[model samples]
Target: MELTWLELFIIVLASFRLTRLLVYDQITQFIRSPFFDEVEEEDEFGQKETYLVPKNRGIRGFFGQLLSCHWCTGVWCAIFICALFFVYYSIAFPLLLVLAVAGLASIIEVIVQKWLED
Candidate 1:
């Protein structure tokens, strides 16, 4: 099945937001908490930041590492979104639409924040 430009754009944004939701959003902390531990570390500038430390050594560790890395998670999210779009467009479209809108909003929010900061 071929996608129009708009559908491709939606898939990209939906994947982006889904990846962010899984990897960085506070609301999904519970999902990550099972595989990782939150550890606070001090940077060179003396600023403390929380990081996810994997809590296991085999399959669990693999999954924890996958969930924590944005690029890793994004690739899977893109594949999942694209697969679902191809296999179940009617069911996936509404959810993809929501995620795409959210993704666009998130991009705008970051840009605006940086613009204001400068």
Candidate 2:
């Protein structure tokens, strides 16, 4: 099946947003809390950042590693979204639209924040 440019754009945006939601968003912390531990680390500049360390072995560790890395999660998210879109376009379109809109809104929000900061 061939994907049109618009469909491709939607899939990419949806994947990106979904990956971010799974890996970085506070709303999904409960899901990650079981597999990973949050560790606070200080940089040379004395800035502290929270990091997720895998807390289990085997399957749980695999999931923990997957959930903690944006690049790894994004690949899976893109594959999952694309496969769903191809197999169930009617059902997936609405979800994809929501994710795409949210992703665009998030990018715009970041841009506006940076503009304001400048």
Candidate 3:
């Protein structure tokens, strides 16, 4: 069966949203795990000292870590599937347009995040 660009966009977006909801806590814990790698003790300033965990990823480990990064994995899968769809339909412009929009959105998101952090 043939699918339109809009349909593909909806499918990918919806899949990402669903996976996000399901994996939120695991994702959060994965993010927070780095803090635990340090020796939890008092600093000279009487505050806590912590160190960031350096994750080691080699070959299979790299792919495993990537697979565990839920949102990134979702986006990667979605892009691959969209690329396959484009190849099947022999439509280059639509894929390029989608990638362009994604890039714009990423830039906007980075700007918004920076603003929020300030």
Q: Return the top candidate by TM-score.
A: 1
Model 3 residue pairs with clashes: none
Q: In lDDT terms, how accurate is model 1? A: 0.94
User: How would you encode candidate 3's per-residue C-alpha lDDT over 16-105 as one tens digit per residue?
Assistant: 543453334454556445423344678889999764332465554554455456767677756765666556545654554565465456
Which stretches of model 1 miss by more than 4 angstroms?
Answer: 40-50
Candidate 2 per-residue C-alpha lDDT over 1-113 given as tens digits, one digit per residue, 9 for 90 to 100 = 78899998999999989999999999998988888887999999999999779877988899998987899999999999988999999999999999999999999999999
Q: Among all windows of ten consecutive residues in candidate 1, which has the lowest summed lDDT?
A: 51-60
RMSD of 2: 2.6
User: lDDT of candidate 2?
Assistant: 0.92
lDDT of each: 0.94, 0.92, 0.56
Clashing residue pairs in candidate 2 are none
TM-score of model number 2 = 0.87
Which sequence of candidate numbers ranks them by lDDT, best first?
1, 2, 3
Comparing 1 and 3 by TM-score, which wins?
1
> Candidate 3 — which residues are off by over 4 angstroms?
1-6, 13-55, 90-118
Question: In candidate 1, what are the lDDT values of residues 36-107, reduced to their tens digit?
Answer: 987999999999999779877887788898997999999999999999999999999999999999999999
RMSD in angstroms between candidate 1 and the native structure over all alpha carbons: 2.3
Query: Best candidate per lDDT, number?
Result: 1
